[model samples]
Target: MISKLNLENILFLDIETVPETENFSDLDNTKQDLWEAKSRYQRKKDFTPDEFYDRAGIWAEFGKIICISVGYFNIEGDIRTFRVTSFYGDEIKILKDFKNLLLFHFSQTKHLLCAHNGKEFDFPYIARRMIIHNIELPYKLNLFGKKPWEVPHLDTLELWKFGDYKTYTSLKLLTNVLGIPSPKDDIDGSEVYNVYYKDNNIDRIITYCEKDTIAVAQIFLRLRGDDLLNDDEIKHI
Candidate 1:
């Protein structure tokens, strides 16, 4: 499938997210009850809602996107460069800018949005957050009546799955097996909340998000049986 697709047409992306608020106490009483109800299945019997609040970012309703970094392959004569860009700061502004990019540049039928485990996490999370912010959904993301195959969203994780339904693959595991450099060298998803709220380090989070986007693009290349990107071929824009 990847061999039939143009790498240049795929906009590879990854996002970093954090809990909507600094702590659980920040939520109102009704929301607190809702969170408790929503999280009870995952939280261990000993773990309270406050203790499990660190994981709120995984759900779009309880958390917000802090960084969304994207990369695309730019092929020149005998050379291929992957250029990366990121949108951070205010969530609504970030979503708006990203939506504009999609609307203006990648709105063509051949263009695709690619991410690892995007079908389950990144794609739906973005759509849900956009609705929450009352922003119009990008054409690629709005799947109101489109057939499954017509969605134009690519999931590297889904491709890797093939037919197996029981197994789950993490991006870190996929990169390790495929010989791509690890993107989680500095911080994994678990630490983003603390890094964003406690340390107040949006730059660090953006850098980490961009690394994951780069890794996603590299993984896609590997899936297409191409060589990993070289250091000189990476340009941060």
Candidate 2:
């Protein structure tokens, strides 16, 4: 099914998020209590809610999107180009810009959004954040009443699972095994919080996010038994 799909109709993307604030104390009293409850099982006995706050970005309720990098194929004649772009900075602006992209261009019934681990993370995370900001969900993101086969989304991690159900594969690990260039050369997901808060570097995070987006597209091409995209064919717009 993947091989028969049109690459031009798919939008590949990845997101980078950080806790809504720099510290756990930055949250209101009510939110702090909610954090403690939300993170209890994951943090375990090793870390307090404050100590585990760095990872709050994993949840849509606690974190805010700082960057969303997306890539789509632009084909003209025999030329192939994967145009990449990002919407970063203010969370509201970011969400609005993404929604605009979806509505104006990629909102068709044949269009689909693709991301790594998207079904579990990226897709829902975007939707939840948009709702928090009161941004209307785009057709691609709104899944309120959609049946299983009616959803217009694709996940690289889920594709790799192939009904294993228990398998989990990191993008870095998958790229390494599949002969695609690793997207984890520099900082990884774990280091994003510090890079954004402590180091005050968002450009680095944006670059990383775009790399992952490209890696996802490459992984999809590999899954379809297609040739990998060359460096010259990737354009950051």
Root-mean-square deviation of every model = 0.8, 0.6
Q: Write the per-residue lDDT of candidate 1 for residues 1-237, one digit (tens) a residue.
A: 688888889999998888899999999999899999999999969799999999999999999998899999999888999999999999999999999989998999999999999999999999999999999898999999999889989988988999888889999999999988999999999999888999999999999999999999999888888889999999999
Question: What is the lDDT, from 0 to 100, of the residue 178 in candidate 2?
Answer: 100
Name model 1 segments beyond 4 Å from true: none
Per-model TM-score, in order, reads: 0.98, 0.99
TM-score leader: 2
What's the lDDT of the predicted structure labeled candidate 1? Answer: 0.93
Residue-by-residue lDDT tens digits, candidate 2, 1-237: 999999999999999999999999999999999999999999899999999999999999999999999999998998999999999999999999999999999989999999999999999999999999888899899998999999999999999999898889999999999999999999999999999999999999999999999999999999999889999999999
* Ten residues in sequence with the least summed lDDT for candidate 1: 1-10
lDDT of each candidate versus the true structure: 0.93, 0.97
Task: List candidate 2 segments past 4 Å from native.
Answer: none
Candidate 2 clash pair list: none
